[model samples]
Target: MTEMENKAVGYTVQQGVATITMQSAPVNALSRAVRVGLIDGIESALSDDSVSAIVITSSLALFSGGADISEFSGGDLSPNLPEVLDKIENATKPVVAVLPGPAFGGGLEVALACHHRITFAGNQVGLPEVNLGILPGAGGTQRLPRLADPATALTMIVTGKPTSVVKLPGVFDKISDKPEHLLEDTKQYLASLNAENCIKRTSDITLTMSEEVQGVFDAVTAQTKKAARGFFAPLKCIEAVKGAYTLAFEDGLKHEGKLFMECMNTPQARAQQHFFFAERAAGHVSDFDKSTPERSIEKVAVIGAGTMGGGIAMNFANAGIPVTMLELKQEALDKGLALIRKNYENSAKKGKLTQEQVETRMALLSGTTTYDDLADVDLVIEAVFEKMEVKKTVFTTLDKVCKPGAILASNTSTLDVNEIAACTSRPQDVIGLHFFSPANVMKLLEVVKAEDTSADVIKTCMKLAKRIKKVAVLVGVCFGFVGNRMIEPYGREANRLLLEGASPEQVDRVLTQFGMPMGPFTMGDMAGLDIGYYVRQSRQAFISHDPTYGAVADRLVEKDRNGLKTGRGAYLYEAGSRVPIPDPEVLEIAKQEAARLGVTQRDDISDEEILVRCLYTLINEGACILEEGIAAKSSDIDVIYVYGYGFPVYRGGPMQYADEVGLGEIVDKLSTYAERLGDYGKMWLQPSDLLIKLAQERSSFAKFKN
Candidate 1:
């Protein structure tokens, strides 16, 4: 005698089907009440003779965001999500899960319990529990391999990366184009899958390996070693997948569950999860009223047609917005426009975009050498050279030509947004929209708020960044704002370290080992050392007194070895490719520079020292940035690094990495480094007092909210 009771879960039995919906708002996070309701819902559906089949879905934008993250941090797991999902898997009635948005974490586990999964187009699904100091305890590790190949399951679970619905491969039974008609569509598909059999458990299925499975595993391992590096979850994910091949059904489930629990207690998982929420938290700012009106940004204009402007224009154009790109000369405009077409063409070649879609988007872009085209734009982003006078001139011209109520923005990486705003008649409308290099691809957008900038203007800029598929971090105005401000010292330390003992290759290798995509020398080579040389020249007076600050970078620029563009820099490149070779000349130069700087050249620089010098310095500066209010929160700084600077996702970001290293230990190391090296060396080495204070109280950056 199964009974139906309405609670956190909503259930309806109609026309031989029972639709069980997780009725939690925001993100249907699997809570205790929801788990209990789900278990009861499955039982009721299974006992009802009228309900021949059952369908499960979420009543939110997301199917399920996994388990409530807060539950694992000392909060009870509530009858436990795994226990509830087990009941669903054992249900006699055939169960189907229809996913509209993302089925993440336990959400994916719930779907895995059902015999079949039907997802809508654009849906994202993954077992991302590895990020939260836990693995998918709800049978995800055991069931994923039964549904997909071991290698595919390994990649999805271990990496904790999302799989797009368009490229889901073997994860789901079917993916429909129209999600609004998902139930009907799924029912029609289910009619085809109908048999005498009832719901079957994924654990009972035997996974067959392909002939190239070993080769596949080998390739995946090699890439994971390079990409994940110090991260443990990815390797553990591989182990879980291998379990499917070596162990029996029950044994595999036990092995998977054990590994999943081991991942839950790892420091890496905690850090990654902290970063996950930090990224979402980056959007919130104090005094930024929710009621602030967002300007309608449809037709947009970019003042410069160079690389930055071209990329910025592409972001707007890619979002289906009509963008007018302006350049001073026809030749410059043509060159920029050609690059835009080439970018689209490259994307089409990579199958990232369809040819017709590329052409359609490219057709939406227009170019001009005059300000008349700017009149119709709701927003204008000035990407001219980062000079105050040039920016002021552009703003002055824009003020006269742009229509009223239009938002004016500067894509300045470090320059003062307030100074740029000062040139305009409507200073309140001026805001900073700092996009990382390769704007169309990079996710970070530092939304700098000037003292006089209107709330609506800032809100509109943040909203616009999202519309263009960029992660916008609301920041207070500063010289370099959040990302680049902290980056200055971090980059400075890398250069200083080279002059002290480390070579270009050694420095980059050390930082790369610490999980940075590239070291300072490699980055310098990529960005062209001349830019840093020029920036140093701009700040010569401030840095000149300290020979350790700009000397090595100045020497690199003086050698006329700019970067990859010149086939030489800190490291030499083998023509046409970006791969760096350890140049003997650069090593000799580093030795000479160390001698010249009166710094000890030691061959015994431990990997630990190298990691601490590079990462801790970056984290210390992040703390300073937080204190100065340049960044709204520690999470904002984390987002700046994770997205903008290629900080490793699994280690979270610099701030989360600091928490993992134990902030007290970081303070001790910084104090030791400061004592050995002078203040110049200690500039970045000094521990953030905020970090020290937090450490003393046994707190974490994750605990500190804005």
Candidate 2:
């Protein structure tokens, strides 16, 4: 027996079979070193007379996680992935790939190049490059369609979700029943194959499209266009997959490469890639390392059985943790439990959950009207009314009933967390777990760290957020934390646009065209117009300086137009539908308000002006957030907005979008607006000091270290 081993690849020969095992730990990413080793191993096996067959597998459980993303910015390296795949495909000896775990992207491309493929029953494989704003660059787009049906291949490519090997009948020659015996099973299977079954390469397969196939392609393309919206990669993926039927193997590969490069060069690709790295970066807290101890959170309790409370309890119950919900009365408790049951029933009807799973999750939840039932709970989150006095009463009661080691949290979005903590004797155990509305669905969980919040409590909630499948961004105590704080300016500007003579539909149209899921007025209507009106009333002293602040929403609430619940708001909505219809009376109110406020109204308010005023104001607030160190980095703010507020992911959140638009140009435009509109614009549109400084230095918010 002869054995050769390098850092990334290991080769050994026994009898007539040669085995190549990728040795990179963890996911075994296809870096430059692995590519070089693969090329060498294939060449050595082909030249050796004693070796009649060769097998390629991995030392770790996973075959590979595609290419090393870190090397993408390093430009073309020697022994690139394409060259490595070509060498494997051109080998004269029979080649087989044995997958033990997931084979994704370039790893799956390499498997397609082999003469035969084998996998275990539970192993997964896919080409997920479209998620990164690029299609498979190393022959994945061309070769996968040859091995699988074009429709299935297109679906896999566009969705970027993995498929189990058991479901794919023809994709693998053999699937091992026992994953632990994969290597031994592959060797026996390779030896059993003679010349008739051994020499089938995916590249030699021909694709013939019938009329039905062409119709499927057309239908899928139209569906993708509608779902992808303004994104570019998914359509390019379809174009590349179509080349397999229309062109030869080499020409199809060339076509895929051209499309891949075109996608890579686009701004959307850069934004998506930035977001991918930014999300991972947001999880890291500089002050707390991995060694920091976290408190055990086995059982949790939610105070108040309102909408937010029920949603928060569902999150814990879904994570397999028992949850107790407390309400003031049994009627309220029963109603909240009914709403939770209805939500799960709806999901079961939609096939998102099985009846068994819904029953199991519901079994984990319990309700009580007494605060004494929360004595042994590990954590208690107060989702009571938004009023300071109401929140204080709940915390003061929780402090008296809860055990000494139990954690106390509040779900208040805009109130002072520190003041809430002051109600409890143990301020160190008090932290804010400001979950977004409909907490079980929304991904963002703003972990509010008060002035005296202990490090261990912060670490525990941050880890708990991950357990419940939410992205936790650590934010300092402030009025609205990161997302809602920045939104103050954005909402202000949307209201101001109405006073300046733009129709609600016109403003909404421009924002939706710019890639927002819905315009500000539409969002307010869905969230209820009175929510903001109540918040403004609570902060009357702070907002009293500007009489026009939230004027439109206040008027709507005064007219008893409470939104979808009341069937009227900024825009009219038919009963049982959330679609916004423009109302003449709303516009009339805007004109009357403008006349009373002594504001000048213009007939032609350009979309560009509307877009700049709203978005730039949001970015300026983000800059101030960074300057105050409320957020550790700009990417954390991006994480909150993208996951919480329906900010488009393709734009890479507001801060990353600011970097793309050039900070210098933004500062210049804010100056123009500030000078154009006098005091009101100066108060709202002035650039932050950090923003102006970065603009003068020719830098970006993305580069801001803190």
Candidate 3:
């Protein structure tokens, strides 16, 4: 027996079989050292007379996550991934890969290059580089189609989702029942293969461009174009897959390389990459490090049984935690539970959940009408009405009912969390978990840290957000918090545009074309016009300074146009449909309001002006959010907008989009708009101090440190 161990790769030869194991822990990314180790191990195994076969596997659980993303900016590292894969493919000795877990991106490419692949039952594999806004650059696009059917391969690549090895029967030569016996099973399978069954190279396999192949490409292209609108990489992935059938193996690799570089150079790719990093950065809390202790959150209770409260309860139940949903009356509790079950049933009908799984999730939920029932729960989140007095009443009750050290949280989007905490004797226990509408589905959870919120509570909620599959961004206590706070100006500008003679459809079209999920007016229509009307009415003292603020929406509510529920709002909706149709009546109302307010209407408001006025105002508010330390970083605000508010991912939220637009240019545009619009614009368009300083210094929001 012979054994060799190095930093990145370990080599051993036993019983005529040489084994190469990647030693990098926690997703063995192919770094420079790992690449050199792979090359040397292959060379050594090939040269050794006693070694008849080479078995490659990972010392850790996963084969690899992909290339070292940190090295992406380093440019041209030695022994690039393609070269390392080529060395494996060209080797004369039988090369076998045993996958115990997921083989993603370049790792899947490496498995394809090997003569045979053996996997454990639960092992998964995929080429998910398209999610990062680039096609696979290391022969994955070419080789995957050769191993799997073209349609299957295209689905995996374009969606960037992993599939289990068991579902893909022929992809691997052998599947082990137990991961512990994977190596032994792999060795036995290798021993069974003679010269005739060994050394099957993927490159030599030819793929015919059948009618079905064309159908697959056409369908996927149409779907990707519609689903991933304003995004560039999904379409590029489809093109690279087509090259596998049309071009020879080597030519396909070269074509894929060209397409990869094309995707890498796009602004969308840079934006998506920034978004990926920003998501990871958002989880970090400056005051709470990894060493910070977290309170246990095994049992959870959610106050209120309305949409928001029921949705919050479902989040915990989905995570397999038992939940007690609290409401004022038994009828309300029964209705909420019924809605939860109906939601799960709908999911089952849509194939998102199995009938059995639906029952299992529902079985985790229970309802209560008394606060005493929540006394033992580790965490209690109040998702009652948005009013401060109502929030104070709930927190005050929770302070008396909940056990010491139990977390008390509010789901208030705009109310001050500090004031809510003040009502509780244990202020440190009171925090804000501002989940977006439909808490079970939306990804963002604004973790609002009130003035006296404990570090332990902050640490626990951040970790709990991950457990519930939500992206928790730590934020300071303020009216509207991070996302809603910034959106105030965005919605204000949309309203102002209406008063200035831009139709709701025109305003919606410009912003949607600019890549927002929906225009502000359409979003208001869907969310119910009265929701914002009531919020504005509650803040009348602060907003009374500006008469025109939210006037268009107020006019809609004054006319009893509630939104989609009423079938008439900013835009009209037909019965049983959510589609927004431009209403002449709404336009007439806007004109009447404008005439009453004595505001001049312009017929020539270009799409550019509409896009700039709305997005720039949103960006300006984000800068103020950052300057006040309400958000730890500009990226946190970006995360909140992207995940919570339906901001475009390809644009990387408003702050990143602002940086791309150039802070200096944004400042100049704000100055121009402020001067152009007079009093209303001056109140809304005045750039924050941080924005002015960054623009003057030619810096970006990305460079602003909290």
Candidate 4:
């Protein structure tokens, strides 16, 4: 049969099934074309005697990611997704949906309209509209409850956890061999079943609720409260699912639509959606096209078999790439190898990896004390102690030993990539691949490009990052690059706030409430206070000579309060657990430091002030980075923080959150704080010119993107 194209839809009939693929590109977003196509496809399927069943799917990665995001903001407006789902619900003939991949939001609603649904093993299903700042508008709240229990459906919809095919409830007919083969399996399953006995529209099924359901609902609500904090969509999603149990199917859908629309209009949703596209846009480099071929890297080499070096080697080996690790002595190499083996054993015990797979990865790794082993490697990453002289010496050696065209990279977090490149003959090959702590687990790689670094080298490193399951952000060379540079101000503000009388626990509580994983002090303990102390000492020239500069940190180091390690840090720690205990000594030190600096302190710090001081400091620095062209865009900064740091995903990234908070408000607050403390506060609270410009124009930090 010929493919029919409606302005709002695309239709193709094959065999006995009429397959309707949503053709909206990029995200395959459901708009007017999708709604009209859905209606027309159903009509065509019902009219044709040859078409026994209709299978709805998408021509993209998602069946339908969600409703058209643009439509929520009133661009190319059409009869919304719920009305489109209504057409599907009222169809006469049985509709079988073949969900290939993610069927979320209106996508899941489209599946619920069908009589039978089948998906592949890797397919992930959800009513994740809530994540985008909306509820599932098209029959999701109503239909999902009928398919799964009200509580399970609510958790899936509210939390936005993708429904894994292996763990899906018995509602879906079968799991197909491949995503593309879903339609065939669905059609065969439909033909095999008696039409009268087959399950029809989700709206026709009665929802079941029990005491277990009530308990699940209660438990999930509590968890969501703790997890989501003050987010509206997750809580509102719970209310919509509750409607499914209390009201009729259509009535429940009405409630869902109302809640969905409310979330769509919220500032939080707008910020989150901005982040959604920004992350996807981060890898785009206008100067580098797809023609720059990535070098074939089947093997990797690591110099220095310390903690980071071992982790870096394991990351390569885990990705099935052979890795050769070099250490100065045989004993050091043996210890590193032993640690790698222990790590694999622990992973296998935890059921994270099988014993055989762990052994397989271990077999791929080879360690040596000599640099000669790195001679034939395609890529070599240096992870020695953070000193420029040591780095230069190592690269200078590698330059002589390693073959030509080999990509040499560094795993330095906060160093000048250009200085490191100067040690190597091929500066274009030398790039900074700053892996977060415990390199094997962390998902971020800061790919720093020095001034003379080649586009091909950047491209290869990005591809390599993806191959190792890491999100790579191409950045320019700077003192701390993206993550740590912005983090400096954030940490500084947190410390200054403590000097002004807020206790460690109080500061942690406020930041945790604001949706960070932990406050600065708690994180300091976990990371070891000595590292920061060393960095502080190293950068003494950059810091103010005032008494507050390193007084408290130096005192903490002196007292053996090096955090978690010494059983004390910002707060006291028990023997085993990380649960923070309040310490009098530290409190006394903070008070003394406040007095010594001649800074007036407040006993009670409001949550609002604490949040603004800590967060705005980071935002202010991000604006400066944008103005300096250190970061190409505000979104790039967000990506760096979201992946590298523990920034909350639901709140978007820091920059997006700042945008939602209003640039003008932040600038005014900075000026207010600056006016209060005069010179002392001026250094920390100095508002960036970008922030002032954005505030004056009533623009957002996100608009600074290239």
lDDT of residue 170 for candidate 2: 71
lDDT string, candidate 2, 56-144, tens digits: 99988899999998888986578889899889988888899988889999999989898889998888999888888899999998888
Question: TM-scores of the models, in the given order?
Answer: 0.91, 0.97, 0.98, 0.93
- lDDT of every model, 2 decimals: 0.81, 0.90, 0.89, 0.82
Better of 1 and 3 by TM-score: 3
Assess the local accuracy of residue 88 in candidate 2 as a C-alpha lDDT between 0 and 100: 91
lDDT of 3 by residue, 71-178 (tens): 878866989999999999999999998887899998888888898999898788988888788889999889888878777888898888998888777679899998
Native-to-model Cα distance after best TM-score fit, residue 532 in candidate 2, in Å: 0.6
RMSD each, Å = 3.2, 1.7, 1.4, 2.6
> Could you give the candidate ranking by TM-score, starting with the highest?
3, 2, 4, 1
Instruction: Flag the better candidate by TM-score, 2 or 4.
Output: 2
As for model 1, its CA RMSD to the true structure in angstroms is: 3.2
Q: After superposition, how far is residue 428 of candidate 3 from its true place, in Å?
A: 1.0
TM-score of 1: 0.91
TM-score-superior candidate, 1 or 2: 2
- 114: Cα error in model 4, Å: 0.3
